[model samples]
Target: MAKDHTDPIKDLRHNTAQPFEAARAMPPSVYMSDSFLNEELTHIFSKDWFCVGRADSLAEPGDYTTCELAGQPIIVIRDRDGALRAMSNVCLHRMSTLLHGRGKTRAIVCPYHAWTYNLDGSLRGAPGMTRNTGFCKDAYHLPEIRCEEWLGWVFICLNEDTPPVAEQLADVEDLVAGYDMTNYTETFFEEHVWDTNWKVLAENFMESYHLPVCHAGTIGGLSKLEDMVCPPGLPAFNYHTILKDDQLRIAMAHPSNDRLKGDERRTTFLLAIYPSLMITLTPGYFWYLSLHPKGPGQVHIRFGGGMSDDYAGDEDAQSNFEALKTLLDDVNVEDRGCTEKVYRGLCSDHAVPGHLSHLERPNYDFAQYLMARLEEGRAD
Candidate 1:
């Protein structure tokens, strides 16, 4: 059913405007309202530094991946000179979208008309345009989009005015500098469309308060309520910290790593890079989800993870990693179930938000972030 609220935007403001001790879950209508989602699409998704994936994933020239920002199709590729680039994925000739998924493409060729483009996004050739008086192949090319690499991750910004990826995430860099996350190698990449609002999953990751109950079958046992620490978030991101024991292996620093000391070696940082990138970075490994809303009811997720370079070569580490992957997959199953259920409850007519726990500090900050972004958009 469509949301029948008078003003989701007002409700959003009123809900997040409260003090931390008075914070409650945001009104469900904001998650279900078309107008609110459109506000987010315009303000948040369009103007933020959106993380796509790791840079090393496209090491070779011609390697590319496709994504959607707001409603515009985008392509991120490595050009002949080995520089990372982004451009409109739609063909200039007839507006057909180029590239579908991750792959190595010699050039961007439109499936609809076979209009060929160079790796640099310039027009290469066209099927049949020799007779058109107005046709000038040299004058046509795909519009370039801004792309950048911070550490080893690739980020695409739709709004040219948005801050550079490095500056926006500078605090985050300082937080995980000891792990040297750029050296982390991506071991797997997968995409999933879950039946839930994107914020539901984002909030789920923003706090560890749910780990004990929602993830009981898997990672639940690893975390305790007393140890979770949620602090106030910065303008560009929010984060929390939890301690990991040495027994978790990948969650702890490798013996060769001399950079981390004491708790620093075992602490796992849950970073919510604003808009929609949630990263779980520990001393030895990291995983992340880059989310996009499919609609009021679903979210498209770019899921991937990897091991640190410190674990570069060890047969036993490989064995443990495979086991770890299995465990993580189980954890995802638990999260999907929990988040989907939350969305269902939000859609209910009688749904009312409950008070937030102190452990939900990041989530409260996220709501405030949304309001701030929306207000900024309104000002523009």
Candidate 2:
């Protein structure tokens, strides 16, 4: 349990229950305390189904990617049987990390002692353990982790009892049905270490309140506060809708699809899947961020997205993708500056919670989610 220096859990409980008009931001200690971060790693991230990357990226049977979640190294791979598998990346022989990064591998061989395992996590060979009596290689396979495929994305949970991703995200699937997201190809993917708390980035992506001020030169002109719609939070996710008076800049520059009609052509949806998945959907493009806490003040961000098949197959796709990537890069620069400064302010001795704006309803719901997870931890 986290030491109660500022009673943030109490504050979270109180403020999260208030009406939107009277709601308050979470306390700074929630973002600045190492103890609280450790608690979050155990109670929130580890126990939830967290997205890692697009399953489509591992199209081939032997493709794999390595990542760290809750300080535990993980390997997500597509086996020779075309099944997606997740397992502890630690070599069973000497506890060394088996894989360093993304690649195609026929077998996961521990460099330390040459102990080899098949892609399905079954032990294939042990270099010198044959001489030992009573040694059972069958019982020495790499430990498997809970993994699931939702839409076209890959999600893993450390806790075996966590609910299935499909069950939790059923409503979200309906909400985004028109987009045909499963067919969307990933044209861009990158990992970045940002100097901000994971929640800060999650909150930033969940609301459009900062668009006009923080993204003024880029996406700001396309937004109007009156047109924004903030929906109540769900048990598994929270979302807000942004109505554009005109087509998005990229949409205007490329061919539009007939599949989307009316407001779907001009509406944008920003959704935060509790704990760490943030997705933004527009008519022509979609992008997302999967956040992982590195410490109290650092977050590892997996950022990527791509155009819908309709637009991706367009003749102008190469040029439009370049333009869209440039625009997103600029927007990210603006966001990084603001979030880093906010983190610095959070460390101040005089830091305190402030009343939230109506546009920040998503942030309020996020507070609720955090409180619910903390309470669950206490119960356990």
Candidate 3:
């Protein structure tokens, strides 16, 4: 066997603890090591409450969506009784994945040996199992997973002992209350795989430092670094506020509402709920990215956004929606190019951690969250 290499966690531990003023980016190997990815899957994603999608998507009974959490296949269904339920999508009989995508389905049927389950994951039928005297359908429901709904979004936790989503994000809820997220209607949603480390994407969304450079031709001209203010990170999240230019399309399209006052009407909040969820809220609209690490070098992103009720029902909604989507598509193209290049740079032999700018406080907070979780895993 080849000699073992030093673990990247050693570097992560040292770099993460440094004071913010002297802090460096996480070690390059933290973005490229399989071992480090495994640790994150176990200590962070598996235990953290992460949003997958808005609950409104499952409005009708029988509507369901399938997703993967930290590599384990899961299905979220609106049961016949109008309750939302989440459970393993794996067929209990032969271990085949039961659902391929989202749609209306009376029941989940395995494409393999015809094993069937009710919307609530109860085994409804398992053809040929009748011959086995020891088989009991009632005892074999698809393993249930813990799930919660907050501000119209559905969150799931692989580890049942983790705190509830509401409890973890109470402060965030209060901060964005004026936007009325609970009533926001999702107008668009998509999934994409990015060729970059998951943390790279998360950090990219958390800061405005790159906006002036990477998005210069698009929304960059609207941003001013001196006007961006990053508040300290909390146990569950980090957020930054920035004043929006009234000339931007989004600002111009937003309807005035009594829910916000003074500068609140002109400010946008960008938040990263620890581990995965990224949310951007404005008086006019909101959008979010729920990130899932596919591995050290890839991320599965669930991107969705919506308009506040005031604008969602406006006569100009469709035209505005089309315009916003086009703008976002262009921004994503720019982000994908930049992040993929960063991943490539990190893989180079000369790659080394560099001191972070004050503008990168959110990235520093993310590093702290990573270190805390890794340490918790070690203690366990």
Candidate 3 overall lDDT versus native: 0.86
lDDT of 1 by residue, 103-124 (tens): 9989889999999999999999
The residue ranges of model 3 lying beyond 4 angstroms of the native Cα positions read 1-4, 252-256
Error of 1 at 306 (Å): 0.6
Tens-place lDDT per residue, model 2, 6-41, is: 666665677678888888888787887777787798
Which lDDT values do the candidates have, in the order given?
Answer: 0.92, 0.85, 0.86
- Model 2: which ten-residue window has the lowest total lDDT? 246-255
Instruction: Pick the TM-score winner.
Output: 1
Q: Show model 1 residue runs off by greater than 4 Å.
A: none
Worst 10 residues of 3 by lDDT: 248-257
* Candidate 1 vs 3: which has more TM-score: 1
> How many clashes show up per model?
0, 0, 0
Report the number of the highest-lDDT candidate: 1
| Model 2: residues with Cα > 4 Å off, grouped in runs | 1-4, 245-259
> Taking the tens digit of each residue's C-alpha lDDT, what string does model 3 give over 296-316?
889999998877777765788
Looking at model 1, report the run of 10 residues with the lowest lDDT sum.
1-10
